[model samples]
Target: MRLVAPQFQPRTVSAFAIAVFLALTAFANPAGATSPSQTPPRASVMTVATQDRVDTRISGLHTRLQITAAQEELWQKVARVMRDNAGTMDSLRQARASNVNSMSAVDDLKSYGQIADAHADGIRKLTPAFQALYDSMSDVQKKNADLIFQTDHRHSAKKG
Candidate 1:
């Protein structure tokens, strides 16, 4: 495009004619324009917890259309949410750890839910952060990030 621009630049008088022709040709039958009534699908971002890691790397995104700045911001928000819950999640893990070895079967199951609830509570507490993060994203990132996040909303801190 740049190389061709210089060659076209010298044709000052003919530029108007060329512009009108191009405009008309472009408007003749637009192939790329999306219909206004068509609704796009929803998506999310996923985080898989790896060994000794805090930052959540995005995974399982279905949409290719996203902006870089929005993606970066989404990553930051996801990281913050996970980090906020880290302490509580870790505590639950420790509790489960201490009891798992000694406890009977049903108690283990019960404790797991409690731990999950605690983790969810942590997430709920960080709701403001999540909302801010979502709001900050470019529209494209938000759309794709939705699909990615839905993959496994529970990146359970308890790999314990």
Candidate 2:
């Protein structure tokens, strides 16, 4: 099936770049687990693994951005938003998983809508903090940040 891509606003692109990892990871259900009842144990493990992935992404981004001591405070705000966004996505995923068996078609669609809304909301919350950090970046650091986010945006677009 051919999928139509959502048109992303330019400002949200950077926020989406940060969120793409969480969105991708949130969909990785365990192999052979086809139902909600089969998911609890695996879900717990997946939660930890997902958190690890989020942490690794945060740390990698921080390193790649070459954040200095002076930028640490602003960086912390960005990081916190990223972490919070991941947690919000994770919770929504878990809720959907737990009730999968009981959900109607409309319920399923609404659940998905909730996830999409959360993603948009996350981007909204992330943009300002990320903009502050971006503002604090040196020219070289800004270039690095641009490359990093643009790379992610391209990768995600290709996937979509």
Candidate 3:
């Protein structure tokens, strides 16, 4: 059986795409760095800001899902997975950024493969926790969840 349902694929793919874009673009160029030699300061700031955004998204999702007292534990599990996945992606992004200027074409492709692998691993880890929470949801909550995912997918697709 598929780990993810057909309806969920677009949302997952869109999220992954956005994360990849952000990771790559964060290191692309600085608007007004005094010197090309400067690196860590900007990248560090971006990483912290990116992590904050991840946290905000998780909190937003929790609110949007209307998670209840009983569901809190399951919701936390899902949140933890999300945070961990983001951390993994951040690490990968940092590693790639550190060597980005010197990377050969093959190395660049390999770096992308690492990102893709992380995405897949994240989904693999996320699916069951989300499924458990989803199964526990009331019909109204489930509908809300579905709508949120659908809406997010559309928004991300438009941005892409």
Best by TM-score: 2
The clash count of every prediction, one per candidate, is 10, 0, 0
Candidate lDDT (C-alpha), each: 0.39, 0.66, 0.63
Q: Please give the distance, in angstroms, between residue 129's alpha carbon in candidate 3 and its true position after superposition.
A: 0.5
Residue 131 accuracy (lDDT) in model 1: 62
Question: lDDT-based ranking, best first?
Answer: 2, 3, 1
Residue 79: error of model 2 in Å? 0.8
The collision pairs in model 2 are none
Question: What tens digits encode model 3's per-residue C-alpha lDDT throughout 1-160?
Answer: 6345234356356443444333333333222122223222322234676678767877887898899999999999987777676666666666666777777666666666656666667677877888899899999998887777667657755765
Poorly placed runs, candidate 2 (over 4 Å): 1-46
Between the candidate structures 1 and 3, which one is better when assessed by lDDT? 3
Q: State each model's C-alpha RMSD to the native.
A: 24.1, 5.5, 8.7
Residue-by-residue lDDT tens digits, candidate 2, 1-160: 9758578765664544555544444443322122332222322234676688777888988898899999999989987777677666666676667777787766666666666666677778877898898899899988887777677766766776
**Candidate 2: residue 6 lDDT (0-100):** 71
